[model samples]
Target: MQNFLNLCNAVIGEDYVLHEPAKQAPYLQDWRQRATGQCLAVLRPANTEQVAQLVKLCAEYQVPIVPQGGNTGLVLGSIPDQSGTAVVMSLQRLNKIREIDTANSTITVDAGCLLEAIQIAAEQADFLFPLSLASEGSCTIGGNLSTNAGGTAVLRYGNTRELCLGLEVVTADGDIWHGLRGLRKDNSGYDLRDLLIGAEGTLGIITGAVLKLYPKPISQGTAFIAINSIVQAVALLHLAKQQCHANLTGFELINQLSLELVHQHFPQYQRIFQQARRFYVLLELSTYDNEQVTKQLLEHLITTAIEHGLVEDAVVANSIAQAKNCWALRESISAAQAKEGKNIKHDISIPISQIPNFVQDTDAALQLAFPASRMVTFGHLGDGNLHYNVSPPCGTDQDSFLEHHAEINRIVHDKTDQFGGSISAEHGIGTLKKQELLRYKSPVEIKLMRAIKQALDPHNIMNPGKIL
Candidate 1:
């Protein structure tokens, strides 16, 4: 370990290597605080060459290496293991915007750049990079690519995998793969960029990428609609899609429990509708026209939905300020839940057509199995993903409450599989869902994954024991 530290220092200087426990502590734990591990040191590589050198040295020594970005992952994918034999490589220093070609509608950025930063850069260039999330302020683009993160804008722009045009990666053997091209159509034999997009760093370390950009919407409109149930919410989604067509940028479902929690935690932003319903749909519309077309379209859609019995009541944002306020409510769900109590979160997804049935059946099953639990279900209804979470009953001990995590996961995941859905919709199967992946994935699928891992990282040096 001492020799390895000396080599790292000699290669990247002493300031870049953090050997002290205090300095390395934050990188060792994930965002969930569920897994804490020990590491020999945390290396801050400044560029792709430095990353390649570090990987080569680690591989030569047969030492495990964990590539981390932002350290905001819910799963322990970015966290090292208990062995204390791994080196946590932080890509935060490699952040740089290499290029923004408005003609080609592509933005090339370093992996360490924050997702929000990329969005802002695109906006400054009169374009839009629409991959957004609650963690955009902190989550790195590399992490988003590694997990293929899905966000509310997926209905319009698709997930991280679809947003990426190309990637520049450092292979396990210290060879750099520079495939960053901004072509709209590439008839290559195999799409290697897609392979590493959601590999969670098991295949290679993503150093940078060329991401797709879109035209900035000249007009935006938002609405908060109250509905009877998940069934009505799905119906409302179809109605909005039919009425608004491509302008329908987002359609999210929020349950009463989730809204009430937000209201209780954030009293300033109360319900926007005049009357409360069993569920709510937060819909957004965007267009290139700066006229009142957005507002008119929203009102028309809401009126149609009401007439069709899809929505009980609705409120459309009158101004930009109101639209931002409406978005705040949707964005505050995770924080509000954290303030309320310990939550068991599941990011699951199913076919859009079967979402109504899945939600109804899962809610019933969860209520029966955990009578003392309070469920707060919400997420991107347009994309068929939900952040199905459960809050412990009042006065339940935190440790005891969390002990039922396995049981809760089994119930939710089993039903998701039955519906041909994924146990992990957006969040990658880090250490948190690694065991679940083994359980839910078929033997053939697992074998293929293992074969890919062995092919890319024969020595198991790149993020060992993760996503395998």
Candidate 2:
């Protein structure tokens, strides 16, 4: 182990190799503090070449390698196990914007670059990088690509996989695959880029990428609509898609309880409507038309929905500040929930058509099992993903309620499976959901995944014990 550390130190300089326990403490723990891992060392390489060198040394030593970016991942994918046998290869030093090809409408960036940085760079170039996440400020592009993250703009631009045209990865054997060509179409061979994008670093380390960019919208319309139920929200989504077509950028579903919790914690953000409704939709539209045209289109859509009895009331933002405030309310749900108390969070996705039924049946079943438990359900309704969570009954011991974690997850996940949904929508399955994956996935599916893992990572060193 000392020899291995010396070699890694030689490769990237001893200053970048952190072997001391105190120096590695920050990277060893997860963002949510759910778990803290042990690592032989935390290796910070400044560029792709140094990364390749360190990976080669690890491969030669048969040492496990955990590739981490930003360390903002919800899953345990970036952290090593408790055995302390792995080296955490931090990608933060490789943060750089390589190029922005205006003609190609693509941005070539190092994987360690911040998501918000990329967005801002694209905006400066008069283009738009539309992958918008709540953690955009902290999350790295490499982590986003590894997870194939879906965010608020997924309804318009798709997930990170869709936004990326190519990737530069350090393979398990420490070989660099510089396949970062900003091409829109290339059917010559197997799509390795797509394969690595969502592999959660289990296959290889994503060092850089060429991501797709779009023309900046002339104007955007934001509206908050009060609806009766998830069914109405789902209906409103369909109607908005029809009326707004490709211009529809975001459609988030927020239940009344979620809003009340937000207001309870953040009293400054007042409710948009005086009359309380069961659910609300934070809808947005990005169009090439001017502000007046965009406003008119939004008003027409809301008026039509009201006439059809899908919405009770609606408030369209009159200015950019108003629109941001509306989004702030949607974004504050998780923080507010945290302030309220501990809760069980499930990031699940169901088919759009079945979401209403899934919610109705799941809520009833949960009520029957754990009476009076509050459901904090809201998510990107346009994309069929829901951050369905649960809070303990009034005055119930929060910690005691958490003891039912396994049972609650089983109920929710089993119902998700029954409705043909995915247990993980945007968050990838690390060690946290590995067992659940085994239960939900078919034998053949699991077999194929394992085979791929074995084929790509014959030594099982690249982020082992992750999804498979």
**Index of the highest-TM-score prediction:** 2
Query: Which window of 10 residues has the lowest lDDT sum in candidate 1?
Result: 269-278
Residue lDDT tens for model 2, 1-468 = 899999888888999999788999989998778799999899999999999999999999999999999888877888999999999999999889999999999999999999999999999999999999889999999999999999998998899999999899999999999999999899989999999988999999999999999999999999999988888888888899999999999999999999999988999986798888899999999999999999999999999998999989899999898999899999999889988998998999999999999999999999999999999999999999999999999899999999999999999999999999999999999888999999999999999999989999999999988997
List, in order, the clash count of every candidate structure. Answer: 0, 0
Worst 10 residues of 2 by lDDT: 268-277
What is the overall TM-score of model 1 with all chains considered together? 0.98
TM-score of each prediction: 0.98, 0.99
Clashing pairs in 1: none
Q: Quote the lDDT for 38 in model 1.
A: 96
In model 1, what lDDT does residue 98 have? 98
